[model samples]
Target: MTHTITGSAKLLARVRRIKGQAAALEGSLGEGTECMAVLQQIAAIRGAVNGLMLEVLEGHIREHLGPDASAAQRAEDTEAVVAALRSYLK
Candidate 1:
């Protein structure tokens, strides 16, 4: 049930940005930033990651689970997408 991306460059770029955000969070901790500021950075990183996930999920639904696709196929894709989303949320 691996959902394939439709080669959306924008989505790829968002993922790269999320990677950088994660690194920035690590750097903030390494530099001993204030507790509040560090927590804010972490919150921002989480939001960015969620945004990337939502964008990709929307694209998967629109492209892979089209209106004409069978209910079973749509359900399978939905399950895959939800599994990925749940893992990320954790």
Candidate 2:
């Protein structure tokens, strides 16, 4: 979304942090870290990713599906969001 572009710096920072988390997980595996710590790292990565998704998705809904949109437009946007969610969940 255009708003996301305007706010790209913040989103990019989150992505970078998530990438770092994944890299740390890889390093832990390479170094034979214990299973519990590895699992915790994986969970941290998942939470970061989920948080990023929520921010983007909320922005999209607010910008595209707001009250000013026509009924048909809202319906279409809602469908598109549902499809995206379905794919993401899979």
Question: Would you give me the overall lDDT of model 2?
Answer: 0.95
RMSD of each: 2.7, 0.8
Q: 58, model 1: CA deviation in Å?
A: 0.5
Clashing pairs in 2: none
Candidate 2 residues 1-90, lDDT tens each? 686998799999999999999999999999999999999999999999999999999988998899878899999999999999999889
The lDDT for every candidate, in the order shown, is 0.79, 0.95
In model 1, the Cα lDDT at residue 68 comes to 70
Question: What's the C-alpha lDDT at position 3 in model 1?
Answer: 42
lDDT of 1 by residue, 1-90 (tens): 134345566777888888888898899889998999989888988898778777767767887688977999989988987888788777
TM-score of 1: 0.77
